[model samples]
Target chain A: AQSVAQPEDQVNVAEGNPLTVKCTYSVSGNPYLFWYVQYPNRGLQFLLKYITGDNLVKGSYGFEAEFNKSQTSFHLKKPSALVSDSALYFCAVRALGGSSNTGKLIFGQGTTLQVKP
Target chain B: EAGVTQSPTHLIKTRGQQATLRCSPISGHTSVYWYQQALGLGLQFLLWYDEGEERNRGNFPPRFSGRQFPNYSSELNVNALELEDSALYLCASRMTGSHNEQFFGPGTRLTVL
Candidate 1:
């Protein structure tokens, strides 16, 4: 089985402050992690993914995430938050070794990040 | 180039009625995927079509079905729709053998009433 967990329901931050939204995963094999942000009534937009190499991964809209294998965590981070950065964030994981081509994504419950001005 | 596109941004249907959702993949993409985003639920994989064949499907019932066209566009048909079928149906496309990234469309919102 494969799954991702986002521990925070909502994280509020003042503009210009750094923000972090945590995510952890459980999978039979190594995990291929992803981050997507969804604004209200919109489809999710891909932010970044952690496939292999480089524990640190950068994504769109000035966001990044660090993958920690020992802790099975891939936490999303932003150096300085902006009001436009506020949205629903989701963490997803897929088994590194799985039925080839099934290629399904198991997603976390999602976290809402609100950056206030 | 155009991104993935889905039709009928919003649809309302009564219980037991059938519904069909359409999607046109990115110009050169060959793999089309369908996902269900119901309220309070994360995106759930519903179907995958590639090269005019059904590749893999999620744990959805047979009533949930779809097909890919020669042009790589696809259609998802829900037979005997139930109230629970109300969701934002998302269509995504990836080039063949893409290791990770899949581009998504705006998605079709289906309302059951």
Candidate 2:
């Protein structure tokens, strides 16, 4: 079985400061990890993903994540925070096994990050 | 190209009633996925369809059912709905080969009273 965990329910940061939102996963085979952001009344938007190589993957909106196999973590990072970046973030995972996807995305509870100016 | 689109931006149904939500995948995309996001809760996987077939499903009950049409459009049907069924239903779509980059719709707000 595959699972994801976002240990923190919320995170706070000041605008212009660096920020990080942690995520961890557990899956049988190689994991396909993803990060998504959701704004009030808006749909969940894809931020980035970690399918294979390149431990550090850059994504939309100056966001990036580092995949650590030994730590079993894929944490989202931003060089500098912005008030607009404040939103609910979710971590997800799917395993690749056979012809089709091995399983559905097991999502984390999500973290509400508040970035103040 | 247009992204995923869902019908009935908002819906309200009493307990035990049925609710049906529709979704249209991006042009040329052949896979659709359904997820339920309850207020204060994260995305809960519901079902997945590819090439007009049910490729996989989550741990949700049988009441949470759906179907995919030949054109890659889909419908999610919730039977015997209860008050706890209130949540936002998201529909996402992607090309068969590139399932990871799924595009999502604005979502349908389903309220079971």
Candidate 3:
């Protein structure tokens, strides 16, 4: 089955410091990985996705993620953390081939990032 | 372009009652997907609709069903709602094609008492 795992339930970082939110996935074939952030009482906002191109993918709000095929990991990274960046982050994966080409995403449990001022 | 939109931003219902949630996909988008985000269950796909047809569904029960209209908008109906059914129901949309990412709506907060 296709699945995503965000090992950390919470991550803490100081403002202006670099932050990394780890994610690893399992799927039957090549995977489509995505990162999304959700604020309290709001829907998820798309951050970035790795389809088939360059491994380093950049997205909205100064966020980026690195796709490592060997390790099956796509970790979200930010050069500098901000208080506004503190939110619930989710890692999702969708399989590319076979019967799992339904385009439905399998999401991780989510990670909460706390950026201290 | 306008993004996906959902109705009844917040809903409160009692156990055994039914709930209906609606969604309008972004213009020119033909695929609409529904997901449930319960407290414990992170985010699970509920149903997928494209071009007025039900394309796929998740591991949910028959009580959890939905349909897509001719305009490509959709509605999800949950029968015999239980306390566990209380969750944030999210609606997402994408163009009918490969390698397309879905855009989500604000979501409907359904509370079952």
Which is the leading candidate under TM-score?
A: 3
In terms of lDDT, model 3 sits at 0.94
A32-72: candidate 2 lDDT, tens digit per residue: 88999999887889999998989999999999999999999
By lDDT, the better pick of 2 and 3 is: 3
Q: With candidate 1 superimposed using the best TM-score fit, by how many Å does residue B57's alpha carbon deviate from the native?
A: 1.2
Predicted complex 2: DockQ? 0.65
Model 1, range A6-71, lDDT digits (tens) per residue? 999999999999999999999887678899999998887999999889999999989999999999
- Residue A29 C-alpha lDDT in model 3: 85
TM-score of chain B of each: 0.98, 0.96, 0.98
How far is B75's C-alpha from truth in model 2 (Å)? 0.1
When candidate 3 is compared with the true two-chain complex, its DockQ is: 0.85
| Candidate 3 C-alpha lDDT tens digits along B6-112 | 99999999999999999999999999999999998899999999888888999999999999999999999999999999999999998977788899999999999
Provide all candidates' interface root-mean-square deviations.
Answer: 1.1, 1.8, 0.6
Q: Write the per-residue lDDT of candidate 3 for residues A13-113, one digit (tens) a residue.
A: 99999999999999998899999999999988899889998999999999999999999999999999999999999999989787878879899999999
Q: Which rank order by TM-score, best down to worst?
A: 3, 1, 2
C-alpha TM-scores of all predictions: 0.96, 0.95, 0.98
Model 3 CA lDDT for position A51:
92
Q: Across residues B1-113, which tens digit of lDDT does each residue of candidate 2 receive?
A: 78899999999999999999999999998889999999776788899999999988977899999999999899999999998899999998877664357778999999988
Rate residue A10 of model 1 by lDDT.
98
| Candidate with better lDDT, 1 vs 2 | 1
Q: What is the lDDT of residue B33 in candidate 3?
A: 94
